[model samples]
Target: MMMMQKPLLLLAALTLCCCITSLHAYRKRGCHCIQTTHNQVPRKCIRKIEVIPVSGQCRQTEILITRRNGHRVCVDPEEKWVLELLTKLYSENETSSRTNVSTNASSKLDA
Candidate 1:
């Protein structure tokens, strides 16, 4: 009975250690946003933004924006400046598109 108890305790200890190790391994990794630019100025510097994780690991999320022109933008909730910049960019893009459409329609009407 004593030998059996010793084996059971050893197994329990090993199991506990394995569980702890797995938990540590599963922990999230931190990440920061960086800017890329086609020209001299780095996009990050112009944007003045860095992304931090709001929940979980930053790498685990797909928090980046890709422009049609092949520009990459990072997204993170912790970076309010970046968020605002993105919002402005979106608004401007939408406005420009709308204006172009309106201009085309007007030209068609004139024709």
Candidate 2:
């Protein structure tokens, strides 16, 4: 029984590692992308980024994004629309976190 459990545990760990590795593949930095030409169809992918943590600051660090059709693309990280979208996401997160903290504090005080 104990031997069976050991293998099961190892398998679970391996599965988790594989999942994490695959997730990182989808969030790859500096993906080798071809230069776009006028003839190709445009991808409908939305930009996503892995915000890097450095010196206690969170910063947009890459051009990884996905399409509605599950396709991934590496875009120009410094594009104006990309920056605007990142800023919008960050602000939304900040406000939601503040609201959560305030709600938790009020509940604790009422208890």
Candidate 3:
């Protein structure tokens, strides 16, 4: 029975290691990693770039950010500036869409 118990313990250890390795790989694959060095601060140094949906891939879809002058910038997604930009852009898009819908409805009523 002692030999059987040792094999079971060894199996459990191997299973734990496999689980840990798999989790690490999953997180690495799904995570949006910032490849920039730790010292870069584009948010503080450069201005915020306006996100235009119709601009036709002004940036690749991978959390790309830009400076105010329409130049590419890299920043952490968690940064305050990135959050503010996201909020501002979302609000503008929402408002503009609402305006378009209202105008369309009003025009149909007029006709």
Candidate 4:
């Protein structure tokens, strides 16, 4: 009876661990947003913006906006203002990268 109890306890422990592991993986693979807004948020209040593209886990593009007050808001990616904002930021990044490359090349030439 003692040996039987030990095996049963071991099996229970393994089963519980497997259940917990699968639950955690499910949550990580799920979409991050529960709800999102379509209304335009004020640019002045925005502290940072994160754009997450669609993948096997998330079906739609997600735009997470962090406000100055330290609150995060999820905005609809298809909104006109959102599209415009992403486009402007993309251009700025491209220009900044180009400027950095040119500066580095010039510095190397000088050396």
Candidate 5:
């Protein structure tokens, strides 16, 4: 009985340790933003924009903006200003890509 109890106790300790390690790993990979702000930041002050899509690690989309002052802000994705900024950026990307494609095709034709 004593021998059996020792092995059982050892097994329990090992299981607990494994569970804690797995939980720590899971927590490390989850959600970059703790909260999002609704205040509208002027475009001139923004230095960079990062849009992280929803994935298995994060449950929702995250928009992180870096300011010229070197501060990072997480903005609510659903805010009206945020939506408008995203639309403008996306359209600019589309236009830029189209221009690049057209230029490439023309250059190839000339060659």
Candidate 6:
């Protein structure tokens, strides 16, 4: 009985250590992305622009051009429209820290 109890306690302790280490590693490997609106223009139509944060404070801007021909295109232009869209998107989709962490972990596994 004593021998069995020692091994069980050791196993429990090892499991706890592994859980903590994995949690830390996961946090370190994940990133936080935020989208924000950079600009919008009314040139016969509304062109919404936004930026998506790829990692940390780094972002990629995208422009959504709404043409008079009733067609909308998403483009990564060097214009201010991309910034506008990013801002709007980020504000609307911003998740809590816990949710973000889970999403990051899942994304990492998928990648």
Top lDDT model: 5
- Local accuracy by lDDT, each model: 0.47, 0.47, 0.47, 0.72, 0.76, 0.46
Model 6 ranges with Cα > 4 A deviation? 28-35, 41-111
Q: How high a TM-score does candidate 2 get? A: 0.38
Best by TM-score: 5
Q: Which segments of candidate 4 are over 4 A away from where they belong? A: 1-29, 99-111
Query: For candidate 4, which ten residues in a row score worst on lDDT?
Result: 102-111
Off by over 4 Å in 1: 1-4, 20-28, 32-53, 58-63, 75-111
Higher-scoring candidate on TM-score, 1 or 5: 5
Total clashing pairs for each candidate: 0, 0, 1, 0, 0, 20
Of candidates 5 and 2, the better by lDDT:
5
* Residues 23-102, model 6: lDDT tens digits: 77864533222332334445446433222235543334333444555555554445565445445445554542223423
Our tally of clashes for model 5 stands at: 0
* TM-score between model 6 and native: 0.32
lDDT of candidate 1?
A: 0.47
| Candidate 4 deviation (Cα RMSD) | 10.4
Off by over 4 Å in 5: 1-27, 97-111
lDDT of 2 by residue, 6-46 (tens): 99999999999999999878843432334322222233344
In Å, residue 16's CA in model 4 sits off its true spot by: 17
Stretches of candidate 2 off by over 4 Å are 1-48, 51-61, 98-111
Q: Give the C-alpha miss distance for residue 92 in model 3, angstroms.
A: 1.0
lDDT of 3 at 55: 24
Q: Higher-TM-score candidate among 3 and 5?
A: 5
The digit string of per-residue lDDT tens for model 1 on 1-111 reads 998999999999999999999998975645534543223323434423222334454443224444445555655443555456546655665666654323321111110
What would you estimate as the lDDT of candidate 6? 0.46
Candidate 3: misplaced stretches above 4 Å?
A: 1-34, 37-62, 67-70, 99-111
State how far residue 77 of model 3 sits from its true place (Å). Answer: 0.4
Model 1 / residue 1 / CA error / Å: 6.4
